[model samples]
Target: MHVSSHHQPLLVALSVAVAVFTAYVALDLAGRQRATAGAARWAWLGAAAVAMGGGIWSMHFIAMLALVTPVPVAYDLTITLVSLALPIVVTGGALALTARDGLAWGRLALGGLVMGGGIVLMHYVGMAAITMDGVVTYDPGLVALSALIAVAAATAALRLAGAIRTRAQRAIGAVTMGAAVIGMHFVGMAAATFTFHEGKAQRWFEASPVEAPVLALQVAGVTGIVLALALTSSALARRSAERKAREVEATLAEERQSSETLLRQSEERLRLAVQATGLGTWDWDMARDAILWSERTYALFGLAPGSAVDYTRFLQAVHPDDRAVVEAAVRTALAPEGDGRLEAEFRALQPDGAVRWLSTQGQTHFESGASATGERRPVRLLGTILDITARRLAEERLRASLQEKEMLLREVHHRVKNNMQAITAILQLEAAQVADEKAREGFAAVGQRIQAMARLHEQLYSAQDLRRIDLGSYFAELGQGLAALHVGQPVCIEAAVEPLVCDLDTAMPLGLIANELVTNSLKHAFPDGRSGTVRIRLFREGDDVVFEVSDDGVGSETGERAKGLGKRLIEALAQQVQAQLDINRAGGYRSLFRMPGTRFTAPDAAVAPTETVG
Candidate 1:
């Protein structure tokens, strides 16, 4: 008996087209599932498997309904249900395995094999579901070829689904996967052979041959509707995701633009600040042996703008005397033990042969790279230079002016001393010419007073500080001169003059007072050639000074002697210095003068006189 499918060519073609279209939709859904995460991914996988399995089962039943045989055909309910389940289970497993991240080739091949085997088994099982009056047989060669075709188609479809990424690729892959599924179904159908009896009856609990076609059509229509719904949902979700991505990109672009604007503004402010301060900045790359100087730096060095120079040129511009010093300072700052700070003031020789004083402050920055054995090394020197020539010139001029003034002052003091000495000589010569004792004594006293002031100018001239006199030395010299003048009396003169300094204003008055007191003691205190000692003391007492002159001799006939010209001169001199005077005549004649607001100290005690003979 000849065994063949009596299915109508038009219905068979329609069923194949529906099955291929359904496969395309399922493959598209599976490709989308790869982008989903967690539970959502599984949902997409389940949906895709259901659509594909339903489409395959629907196509099989529709094609079966198209078949016409001599005896009526039916399907076993249990076996038909099992055939529907096979595709769904196998498709779900294959999708799940392919969804994994970094899916290896070995794993993909294993999944393909399992899925292909299931497809082949489902096709044969569905064929077994047919219950008829005749026995059905499958040609061993054709059946094997059909099974091989199913496995090959299933593997190819899975590979396409896994590999497809972009929408265009997915669309292409969809059509490809569709062809594979449709081809497998037809090849399996061609492998079947059925033998029919003369009379056949449909068994109980079997599907009616005529009604199966209508039911198959309904199932195919429902599967097509479900697939259409899934494709629509996927398209809407893709559009939503794309819209969100565009919004994010727009926000990022705006942020980047804002950041660039802020950075440009900051750099502009820094450039303005550097220009305003007249700062010449420099950056030296030690590793590259190159130097970058700001525009102001070229101006500072008397070079035109955009003039390029290396480190050697920079060094050559420095004054010969200061070049070594500047280089050493830079080296020290860059040394490992150094603190990376540089400070130097030196002279720079300009192109015009003009000298300029420059003050530089800098710091070294250490950076690590492939250089220096991967260790941090001083890679750059950043610094600023300021012109200081104006300040230096001003200071030099001030110093020269001070030296000229000091020289003029010394000359004035020398002239004053010489003029006063000449006046004293005139008075001494006049005394020598006078015959009257009172006149001689008066002239002698006047000459001594002149000499005392002359001595002050002398001390001022000899001293290192022209503004002040060493009073201790002045006093000692004054006492010895007074004693030398009073030659007749064998009086021993002793001085205990402590180291003290006083200005010309104070020294002049104090010297005159001392002159009168000492002269008076020599004149009257030691009477009738009696041997005695006269003592002079100049020392600091608290914040004041004490100038005392005392003589060990017979007391004066009357304290009335204090009222003479000598007394008048002493009183006048004391008043000028703002000093108080005290006289003692018990053991000897003593005159103690104290001047306030005098800040000076003696190395020894002043109250207890340590006498020195002169």
Candidate 2:
């Protein structure tokens, strides 16, 4: 059959129009394919294949109608119907393969081969259905070239279908793909050859055959319906995508609002906590040389709330004497070798010209150059300052009260010592005018006992701590005084006393007891040039103390046990201190007083004088 130029231009234009429309719908479906999943994704793929396949089938039939040959041509109904089904099957498979994520080159190539081979098969099969008293042959080289063009066009179409995104890009891709499809169809048509018999009777084609005009009308009707359905589906998919995007945006907006609410609540709670604890917060930006102080900080510094102050003002508020110390502490905290913690107590000069103590604690944060230099450049310093003025004032008042009490105690002890000394002087004066020798000795003994008590008050007045007396020193002095007063001949007085301390109540009783015992020893232990040693030993014994006064002399006579003032005084004093008295006369006269180590409470009144023990 010879080609006629009369209807060729119209056929080419119709083919191009159908191919372009098919490419447009295919690209639109491909764009929506990613936005769908599961059944929806397959639905879009099927829709794309139907739209493109129907258009391809329509274009093939329209182009065939344009063929003007010497003999009339008709298609076999069965083969043509089978040919129409080929594009739908093959395009569906190809679209499905390329629609998934991570499209592999091998899989895409295979899909191209399958789809191209199907198109070639469908075209040749439709041609084979032509029965017009003739046999058709294909130019092998032209057929091969056409198949190659189909494969190349299919591969490019699949790539564009998967890659195109924007509407303009999609349009461009559709036009390019349309040209490829049209080129493949025309090239395939060019490969066909037809031969007619000279005398064979014509066999009118059956099996659901139709004329070219009827086929063209059928193809146009089907293409129109398929494209309209595709446009409706694409519109619904876009609306669904927009609705989902709006829902996601609304969820994000709600989350942001919730986060802001929580932040405000957290800040409010922190403010309340700081206020309750009377903490003053501060932030110092070292690089900017600026300071931010909370309301409590201004109050702590004796300034109005919202008062502005910088590092220089802070230093000015510090007491002159403490300024250097505060500066040094801050420097140390910001030093590279430092631990970044600060704790300092310093006096601040308030606006009222009064000095107040402040306890400040803070931490330094290094934002940059922390590890690189001689000094760590602090990004910020955050901490609290507390007004410790009330505490300091209370402490000062307490210290003053303590000092005043100490002075009062010392005065009382001084007055007591003076009063006892006055009693001793009166006794000595009365002894000077005594008429009886025994009476004079008694007065002198009484005076010595008064002097012993005066010595205790004297120790209390002289010492820093007046609560307790050094018993060892008191006893040693007492022993020496008694020896000097009573002994006319040389009698060595030896003291073996350990370090012991006792309160005034215990000391007074123990001192009087020692005085009476020593006086008795000095008066009776030796007689008429019988020089001997009197030994006093005061020492700890377990949880008790033993005070022993012994003399190396003849023992007391039997009649001496009848009556004596010294013996009565010794027993009375021992009872007051809750001590047991033991008199030993085996080798020499020895008197031992054993008392509890603890301080004894004062008795209600003086005890009744006890019987003399010799």
Q: Show where candidate 2 strays beyond 4 Å.
A: 1-280, 286-289, 295-313, 331-341, 347-359, 365-378, 386-398, 413-614
Q: What is the lDDT of residue 221 in candidate 1?
A: 80
Tell me the spans in candidate 1 whose CA falls farther than 4 Å from its real position.
6-8, 23-31, 34-73, 76-93, 100-118, 121-167, 191-205, 209-213, 280-293, 301-374, 377-614
* Clashing residue pairs, backbone N/CA/C < 3 A, model 2: none
Q: State candidate 1's TM-score.
A: 0.55
Error of 2 at 322 (Å): 2.1
lDDT per residue, candidate 2, 1-614, as tens digits? 33322245766676678778788888888778766898988888888888877777777777877676767677777888998899889988988878877789998998889878877877887787777756777788889988898888788878887788788998888898888877777777777776777666756554235666666667776786788789778978788888988999999899989999999999999999989988899999987888999988887788887787899999999998998899998988887667889888899887998788999999999755555654556788889999888998899999999989989998998999899999989988999898999899788877888898888888888876677566666777776677667646667777776666668878898788777766666677777878788777777788888888888887775636315676777788889889898887766788888988776322233222111121
Q: How far is candidate 2 from the true structure (C-alpha RMSD, Å)?
A: 10.6
What is the lDDT of every predicted structure here? 0.79, 0.78
